[model samples]
Target: MVYEIGDNANSALKVVDRVTETLRGDQWQPTVSVNEAREKVRIFVKQTDGLVDGLVVMVVGEADKHHGDTGNEAVFVNIVGEIDPAELGRITKKLNIDVDV
Candidate 1:
């Protein structure tokens, strides 16, 4: 579900939106916040999953740097505990994002 470096930003927004909606009302708390200066969104998701209290998934993304340059400026998402990495990977792949968890 990857998109071109110069592709649809709306799709990214939708992915975040979907993820947010899916999290609502669950014991897991998904925090969505933005950094206006960077034009990026940061997501922090955590869930107990009836196992232990910890993180679930962490993801981040932003437009690719211009002219092939590496741009550190991008969206960020972080998940901290025992979670389904496969599902998280699916979300990131679709969103064309990167994360550190």
Candidate 2:
């Protein structure tokens, strides 16, 4: 089932914590970690017939830049299945613009 993560910061943090624990376990080893301060995170899951086909975690935030440099940053995590990379890109774009992703 699709779960819409709540908009509250605490809710987002909770989801991140749960996902972190899951990733730390042997069952699910995330390819990368983008846990950072003041970042937005999105978890995408594509499912069919009650079975998950793909999963992606995206994190966006301001880049750590030198003086006078524009700061921009983005992170995309693909967990499983054959979900389109472009689709994940679109989701990330939307999440970057939306405060309540």
| Best-matching candidate per TM-score | 1
lDDT of 1: 0.48
Backbone clash numbers for all candidates listed = 7, 0
Model 1 Cα lDDT, one tens digit per residue, 1-101: 22333344555556656766665645556544554432455455555544434433323345445646343332434445565655665765655545432
Query: What are the per-residue Cα lDDT tens digits for candidate 2 across 1-101?
Result: 22333333455456566766765563443433545565655564656665556775756554434545254444446657755545655655654434232
Task: Evaluate all candidate structures by whole-model CA lDDT and list the values in order.
Answer: 0.48, 0.52
Model 2: residues >4 Å from true position, as ranges? Answer: 1-11, 23-26, 29-32, 40-52, 56-82, 97-101
What CA RMSD would you report for each candidate? 7.4, 9.2
TM-score per candidate, chains pooled: 0.42, 0.38
Residue 82 of model 2 has an lDDT of: 59
Instruction: For candidate 2, give the lDDT.
Output: 0.52
